[model samples]
Target: MTAIRANSLRNGPDEQGRFGIYGGRFVAETLMPLILDLEKAYRAAQVDPAFQAQVKDLGEHYTGRPSPLYFAERLTAQLGGARVYFKREELNHTGSHKLNNCIGQILLAQRMGKTRIIAETGAGQHGVATATVCARFGLPCTIFMGATDVKRQWPNVLRMKMLGAEVRPVTSGAGTLKDAMNEALRDWVTNVETTYYLIGTAAGPHPYPEMVRNFQSVIGEEIKAQFFEAEGKLPDAVVACVGGGSNAIGTFHAFLDDPSVRLYGAEAGGHGIDVENGHAASMTGGRPGVLHGNRTYLLQDADGQILEGHSISAGLDYPGVGPEHSYLHDTKRVTYVPITDNEALEAFQLCTKLEGIIPALESAHGLAEVIKLAPTMKKDETIVLCLSGRGDKDVESVGRYLGLIE
Candidate 1:
């Protein structure tokens, strides 16, 4: 066990948005004015009581705040060591924690008087969440998705369409999340005046990683209160799967000041880290580089070209992670582990059978880590992992993988 350390880990992302050389406003000069405007608007919103009230009200009513913290009795017994608990973000509206960021951003966009909206999605949960909010707010929206993801994640594509968002399949390199983000950035650059780019993850230019994390921090805030109410103390560990690290940072931020609580982030290892470019475990097998906007760990070749990392979960297919995650990883505030597709698959079935809860493949990666570490800890210790999203969107892809369907 680690001893309690001093200094608050929560106060991060200093003035220029650099999280200890990990994050910054690394964007084109053409976008500087727009980025600055966004930063100003976000800063103003931070101190506005009315804005905060609206965000909280929508969170509670529209997106369903305070998602239950359910004790996983069967899972705990099966692991036979640490007690297990699930922070049920999958029960939120749009079937994932993505809505938490979407709700706050959409409201912020309204405050800025932006009428058109656009976003990029990997596994489609973010697209669905963005589209759902745009529809609720009566804004015209478009979503960029990789062609590969558009096919594998057809159900989510349909969900976005049903919510009245135009889906554009990006057929660029890898045709995955990175490509989708590239396309989204291009759209933002072209239509910066009236279009509000709603980045789905916390890996974009300055203010975005910071803004999204602030909105999603509600996850940890509620977990703190709920866990205290249930067990009268904090969880020994807090774990979540990391794509661009929004959910992981959200769950880790509240307890940053409480050094006694250990934090873990599970990254997608499509096959294994030993297999070059075969995994999406950025922190485990990546070098620091700039991608999208901020400087962070990126899957890149020796020549500095970004590599296409593989993962069974489309949501975890990103080549880079959020900058704060990079800082956390460097500072040893959070332990990062790579979970292969096979491991996630096994963990998915185990959780489904034992707890009767089908988790998103992204969530499954975190579950895989929990399953491994839980059995090694004392029986009284507690481990709480984020059930980031429900498994409904992934049933078809998983069924095909297991040969349960044609």
Candidate 2:
């Protein structure tokens, strides 16, 4: 919908993979060779028509991409302000946008002759997506998940196992997403030759943030064309939830050069922003620090040690955000807002009742922001909210929250 740019949004991270002062390769020496190799492979893949054709074919048939951009007629009428559209990524295969990146990375892994696939997951969506791809390719797969996430996202854990991927629970450091990532990295270091570390989000070392963003950018690209076809104009604001920031970055990438299109990212404000250890709103409540291989805004203590992040949405309960988000925040290219667990829950139910769409809790954070922003805008203005995942994996958690289940 926004006026197209002559060049695609690809001039980020520079040659050294630094998005301003935020992103860079900050991993250990042992992983440097593998990282460099991955960079080379990715660059080659970028220019190879055969690689592009393979990825595109899989995206169309396997992942069911070009997900719809649907106008939320009921929600728009109820809000009585701006028109709201839902970018239905939740409708994609594996029940989330995670599959898009997984499909791309798996193709790269195959091309690189990697025999094993390893990944880390928070809410289990990424793990399930990775496992699904591995199953399709008949490649051995292993997933590292935080002990806490293993308990909370049991459905996804079961899904991963059913897909024939081994799930390893990580117990270090709060036993959450960050710990799972640490364990995954250690595994990559140990088996770099045989294994391809399939990172879930748009974070990690050089190439990863860039690679994931490029894969996930399909969401924004589709939205741009679909919205233009439907409404003849770009939405005034685009919104998505930020954890490791894949979905947010993807949804915002195509519109970066469109000055009139504002971008909003909703972060997890667990209990309340004021409460210590209560939220995962990294950009809003945290300072920049190094974590998980890149320098980014992180929830940390006075000694610079990382702190545990809290959130009802397992996917969003991370201490640090992707480095590109840090750069965007620093430059005020995107406005970051915090949405509490209660607010997200309320919005989750509201969307379900109004539109018959049950969004993942991670996505509900964005819905929460949409609820806040929609009422303040003029009726002619529009907002496009990225519904990043479905809520089937989270039904049990929601039932427990509502005291409808034990």
Largest lDDT belongs to which candidate? 2
Off-target runs (Cα >4 Å) in candidate 1 are 1-6
Estimate the TM-score of every prediction. Answer: 0.98, 0.98
Give one digit per residue, the lDDT tens place, for model 2 in 1-406. 4454454334688888888899899999999999999999999999999999988899999888788899999999999899999999999999999999999999999989999999999999999999999999999999999999999999999999999999999999889999999999999999988999999999999989999999999999999999999889888999999999999999999988887999999999999889998999999999999988899999999999898989999999999999999999998989999999999999999999999999999999999999999999999999999999999989999999999897
lDDT of each candidate versus the true structure: 0.93, 0.94
Candidate 2 residue 281 C-alpha distance from true site, Å: 0.7
In the predicted model 1, the residue pairs found to clash are none
Q: Model 2: number of clashes?
A: 0
